[model samples]
Target chain A: MKFSISRSQFIKTLNDVQRAIASKATIPILTGLKIAVSETGVTLTGSDADISIEATITQSDEKAQLLIEEPGNIVLPARFFGEIVKRLPEDQMTLTVGEGFQTTITSGTSSFNLNGLDANGYPHLPEIDAENKLTLPADILKQIISQTVIAVSNQESRPILTGVHILVKDNQLLAVATDSHRLSQRKLEINNGQGLEYDVIIPGKSLTELSKIITDDLEEVDLRITENQVLFTAGPIKFYSRLLEGNYPDTDRLIPHDATTTIEFNTQKLLASVERASLLSHASQNNVVRLVLDPEAKEGTIYSNSPELGNVQESLAFENLTGEKLDISFNPDYMKDALRSFGPTDIKVAFTSALRPFTLVPSEDEENFIQLITPVRTF
Target chain B: MKFSISRSQFIKTLNDVQRAIASKATIPILTGLKIAVSETGVTLTGSDADISIEATITQSDEKAQLLIEEPGNIVLPARFFGEIVKRLPEDQMTLTVGEGFQTTITSGTSSFNLNGLDANGYPHLPEIDAENKLTLPADILKQIISQTVIAVSNQESRPILTGVHILVKDNQLLAVATDSHRLSQRKLEINNGQGLEYDVIIPGKSLTELSKIITDDLEEVDLRITENQVLFTAGPIKFYSRLLEGNYPDTDRLIPHDATTTIEFNTQKLLASVERASLLSHASQNNVVRLVLDPEAKEGTIYSNSPELGNVQESLAFENLTGEKLDISFNPDYMKDALRSFGPTDIKVAFTSALRPFTLVPSEDEENFIQLITPVRTF
Candidate 1:
């Protein structure tokens, strides 16, 4: 393949696809990024077994300056070639492939000869029909991923739990993720809903990478779901991820509908207080902090103590406190995560008891997200 | 013990000493930070085996509004307590030790009861006489550390090579560090040297921590050396480091005096070119880059190649290339390090041959500092 393209434009496209480049060299060819030049434009593809990303640079209305001299395909080492092209000073870079799959890339006074593999050796990207596709704003997808992805389990013991379960009905989309210790559920309503309901589980890490590539500029993202693969396409970038093949657990039963006490507190203030308490508790354990609500005194106190270190107790102000007084302890990290996911300035925490899971959500609206944490038995 | 002080003041002092706190709990007591309160001031001390830092908050300081009701001492878990105090919201914090070494830390509505150890259990700071002392500008000391510390060997096989050798003779102070493959030597002359001549080896890690604590704005730092300990005192912070007890290797012989060729180049441009070349060579068995000076062409070229990956060649414009035309290959990482340590805008690189070590120094001032990197045989 022979082509010359703008350095920034190429770098941006390469970065989008580079995330899917295989970190583990199980298949040596998988570590290379496949580049193809056609009459339309240049396409870059990178993939591991689980996730694959393909980004295209087209001479479209965006006014991208690209010259296509020959139509062909080749695969070059992803990391090395990417770095070399990025460091080249020229605004436009030229790439040409010759006999024995040798590729020469030149920019200004810098030139690189890279050993390329035959593009035929690389695995083909799974093709997905656009019939069963959903469209949503990129910002909404990014928010859904950020709000719930952190709750996904990193361990592969229960492979399904490592993925975020997405459920859609009518115009509402629900994303839920849990590691048994903590759970996060986010809900969003999109206008362009296909009058169909579907459920799919996509790996949490895949969603994270997809979110990074989607900027916050309110771009439309088309999501296509096939039997075994899911495709997210935005602009000229198309991302394909292998779907988790299993039944997601019924997380509806885990969220409590009733609570003995509910209190409204300032989000930032409570978060800072919890962070301070965590510092002390983190010494003894993985940083567990306790919260005690005294309805009679109309006060909420956060306490954290390390037997070998020291203890901290802080009283937090609450807008409203009702129901029986309660004292509960849980991992501060879990609470911190829950607090961070909260959107509004004020958050309402509903507690069942000291030993049960508690829900934290925005005080004004329940449409954004809800985070639940299981309290630890500090006593 | 009872005292109330500004949270910011306490946090600042804690941060100053926290760097010396032991990360690993090999010695249980070493993980604790000792806090001693007296009528004059409050002192915080943290130490690992390699380095110890003591920072004082004097009652007389305008910024510190300390109320010392009782004088006492206690040791609290270093990392945890430091985090807790830093996160506390109140401007003023109070500390009180009740019966049975139960330390209570309170700020605003937050209070912490941390289990503290007897101050007597904490290791005492080494006592070093100030008789044999060398005073130098803190900025100079910091510059010396930054220039040579990276070359120190991390391996414990040659214990002396893990430290930076500091030699003081008359009014000249010389610092040298090497990991056998590469050596960096820097020298500075001071007026008030007191005619004292001494050689001491300070661990590179200790010096790094000291460098962080010493502000560049400070006029001078008092360096006192004892039998086994070295002390650096500037302003309210006192840093003590254990000296390595081995003779450093003679590095003077390794620096080549006569060179076959010398070239002057812009430091930043050379650094950027080397960095780009390094991206390709870093993946190879020998991370080497070759610089070929062509006097007739009035240009220089930097080349790096990895047989399994690819090869990169870039032309660099040299301000002046004299002596014999040369082509030398060396580890790109060492060259990058040497270039980064170049304090001047223009650097002169003197090469003896393709195998011998070359020296890199300021193009204008050769007396300030010099860094030497040994060439690697690419064949």
Candidate 2:
């Protein structure tokens, strides 16, 4: 195989595929990047068994400026190859494989000779026999993944909770995740998913990598799902992730619909206050901050203290306070994450009781998106 | 004690003093910042026993906007106090200490009550009883520290080698450091240093911290040395570092005056090539790269290889070549550090033999600054 291409263009695609490659793969060959050079284009593949990424640079790509002298396939150490390409002396770098597995990489007066592996040992891409394809805007798809993935459990105790449960039915797409302590659910109205029902649980880590590759430059992404593998096509890149096996817990029943008290606060302002309160709480053993709301007195405050250190209290500026007065305590880190997903909008928070789960939703669109948190019994 | 100061102004002085405060101090009180509020200004001090830094914010300073309501003093947890001050909600914050060393900090609606210690328990700054004072430009002082500190030995086997030997004699200030394998020396001509001879060894760690606080805003820093302590006063900040109590080794005889082979190359280009070669050497057992120079052919090339990975070779772009053909091996990391110290200038490298030490000096000013490295004997 022999080819020379623009370093920047090649680096961009290399970075995207690198996201799926693990430094320590159980299979030795999985750490190598598989490159297939054909008559018209070059395809680069990186995989970590569970997730695989493939990108194609066609001959017609103007920015790539690809020149192919021969056609062949080989696998090279992904990390070392990447580092050498980044430090190459010129704008263009060439890769040539001659006799045996001796591959030579050259740019300007610098030359690197690497031992390549047989590409036949690398696993092939997962094939999906499904014919139906669903399409969604890149931005909206990224939002759904981020909002729900935050609540996914990092603990391996419950393997099923490590993924976000995605469901599409009745022209509406719903994504939800719960770590038993807190749950987040996001909904989007799909114009073409009507009369079709599909349920799958995608690992939070896979979705995170997929969201990063789905940049603003991509207008829309096409998704195809089979029994075990799901593929997302964005521009010249294809992302594939294996679905988690097992049924997700019923988190829908955990969110409380009734509330004893409700208050609306600017997401950014309250986020800052929670951050400050968390500083003291993080120094404490429980890592919980208290919120005391007095509807009749028209005031609210957050209090947190560390036994050996000191205490902090901030008077909260709240709006639309109603119902009975209440006192609640919860893990500030969870609240911080849920608040960040709401961005700078005003969010209405409802408390069922001191020990029950509370819910927070955007004031403008309450029915579409919601984040629920189970409060601690500080008394 | 009670006073309100602009948060930004207070933060600047706080950051400077915080450099001296170590998170894990042998003395608990040493971890707290000593703040003395007087009728004229507020003085903040931080110390880790060996080094102490104090910065004052006067009431007359426009940017400080310090309002002194009362005169008193106290010591508060340096790390926690600095973190709180950075996240305060307003442009200005007020700090007040009541009876029994109870401190109150407030900004906007947020209030923090911290446990404060008695100022009388804090150790006093060392009294350097020196009448004579020498001054140097802040930029030049910073440059001298950066150039030589890189060669200071980090090994604890010989604690005395962890400092840079500084000598001021005959209107010239010279600084040099070495880890036995490599050495760096810098000299500066001082007009007022004549008739004064002083020699001391300052810890490399102290010089690094002093270099950071000696920013471009200050014109000159006044230096005073007496007994075992050295004081550097720059504007409102006073930095004190304890001098090592031992004699430094004589490095004059180690630098070779004659050379069998000589070559000159641009510092930046050589540094880039060395960085590339080090990537492969770092993966190898010996961590060494070989440079083959052919004066007859007017060529030089660097080669490095890893038994498990690959090998890389770069043809060097050099200027003057009036030396015998030779192949030498050296630690690329040491070479990288020496090349970086020269920046982007053309440097002349003098080699005595394949096993002996080599020297590098800027072509423009060869007498003032020089760097030397010992080559590895590769069979």
Candidate 3:
């Protein structure tokens, strides 16, 4: 490939595609990045059998600084190419592929000649029917992914639970994740998804990587789903993730609809209190922290005690308390994660009983998101 | 014991001593920090059998905010205590040790009760004779330690080589370290130890930890050496490190006096070029890079080639090249390290021959420090 491009733009595109490069691939070529230069621009592709990413730089783009001297295709080792491009001494670099797949990259006083593989040996991107297409702001997808991904089960015993269950129907997109201990559900209204519903489970790992690559610049992202894979197009970058095979458990029935006790507190204040209470508990085996709500006192106490280490108790000030006094214990880490993603000034914490799952909702946006955490029997 | 101290000051002192605490200590008591509170103030100590560090906070120091209500001594788990003190919600925390060594730490609306062990189980610091003592500014000691420590051998095959050999005699302080392939030596004129001379080897790891605890506030640090241990007192912190036993190799004869090829180049420029050249070479078996200097052409080229991957060549511009045409291969990482530690606008690289070790010295202050790197034979 004979092309001179702005080093900054090339580096950005390389990073986007590298997200799919496997650290250890069964097919050796999958570890390499495919670079194709044409009259239009250059396209970089990386795939790890399951996930694939492609990023394009066009000559018409002002920041691309692209000059097409020749059109060619080659594959370079992803890691070596990444390191060299990042450390190139100049703002612009030129790449020219010679006979026998020898590629030379020159920038400033530095020159690198790398052994490239034949691009024909690399697999092509899968062609998926774009009948079920949905368009949403990149930031909205990024937020929903982050809010629910953390609750996905990390254990391999249940492969289905390792993926976030995403459902779209009636113009609303719902994302839910659970490890059976804690569950998080987020809902957002999206356009162009009406009457065309898709119920697919995307591996939490892929969504996590996608969230990192997606910028928060409010650009619209087009999502297309196939029977086996889903494609996301953000700006000039295209990301594809394979769907997890199996039926996701119905988690809607698990969320408690009624509460016996509920209290409203500042999100930050409650988060800090739980974090402090978790200090000693995290060092213990159970990692449990208790929440003692006293309606008469108009305050709640977060307490944790580890027999070998010590005990920690923090008083959390609340705006209001209702229902009967309640005492419940749950894993502090789950509560911390749920509280961190709540986007509101205050959060309402509701408890059904000491042994049942509790629900936390942002007071300002109660209808959109709900996080449920099963309480541990500390007694 | 009962006392309330400034949280920030307490946290700083805790961090300073915690560096000596072992991640998994052989002696269970050593995993805990010994905290002693008295009328004067509080003292915290951490030890890992080989090195011990103690930091004291005095009531007279206005920053301490220490109010001693009672006197007592106890040991608390180092990691837990550190985390709690750092995350406390108030500017000041009150610590009280009650019956059975149950300790309570209170700050704002938070309270933590930690199980404490009897302080009598902690090991006592080794007493070192002060007959041979040298005093210097903390910043100077810090600089000398950092400059030479990186060259110390990390392998345990030669335990003595893992320590930096320090010599103070004739109003001069000298520090030298080497790993058989590269050597770094730094010298400074001092006022103390005019007639007293002591040669001791301090473990590089110990010196590295000491360097972090010692601040650059111009405070004087008193260093005392004994038969088996060395003690450093910087401000309110006392650091003790076990000396490495064995004779240090005589590295003075290893430094060449004359050079047939010498070139001066900007330290930063050469460092960047060498770092870039090392990228591919570092992944290869030999980690070698060739330097071809042509005095007639007034330019030098750094080239590295790997048969399996690719090749990289960089042309370096130098201010002056007064040397015969030379082609030599060496480890670029070694050169990068030597260049990074040199403090000057320009550095002079001197070579006696292709096989012998070369010396890199600061062009401005050539007498104070010298770094030697042995070249690897690429043929």
Instruction: Please report the TM-score between candidate 2 and the true structure.
Output: 0.99
Which tens-of-lDDT digit does each residue in B1-379 have in candidate 1? 9999998878878998999997676778889899999988899999997788999998898788998989999988788778777777889989999998888888888888888889998888898866867888888888899999989999998889999999999798889999999999988887888888879999999999999988856888999998789999978999999999978888888888888888898888888889989987888887889989877767799999888878889999678788787788989898888888884489888898888888888988887778888888766
Q: In model 3, which runs have C-alpha deviations exceeding 4 angstroms?
A: A297-299, B129-132, B192-194
Candidate 2 lDDT tens digits, B80-152:
8898898878889999999889888999999998889999999999998888888999989999999999999
Candidate whose TM-score is highest: 2
Q: If the candidates were sorted by their lDDT against the true structure, best first, what order would they fall in?
A: 2, 3, 1
Q: Pick the candidate with the highest DockQ.
A: 2
DockQ of 1: 0.70
| DockQ per model, Cα | 0.70, 0.80, 0.76
Q: Looking at model 2, give its docking quality level.
A: medium
Give interface RMSD, every candidate, in order: 1.4, 0.9, 1.1
Instruction: Please give the CA lDDT of all the candidate structures.
Output: 0.87, 0.93, 0.90
Residue pairs in clash, model 2:
none
Give the higher-TM-score candidate: 1 or 3.
Answer: 3
Kindly list the per-residue Cα lDDT of model 2 for residues A1-379, writing each as its tens digit.
Answer: 9999999999999999988888889999999999999999999999999999999999999899999999999999999888888998898999999887789999999999988999999999999767788889999999999899999999999988999999988889999999999999999999876466889999999999999999998999988888899999999999999999998877777988899999999998899889888888988899999999999999999998888668889998789999899988999999999999998899999997899999999999999999999998876
- Count residue pairs with overlapping backbones in model 1: 10
- Worst-scoring 10-residue span by lDDT in model 2 chain B: B189-198
Q: Which sequence of candidate numbers ranks them by DockQ, best first? A: 2, 3, 1
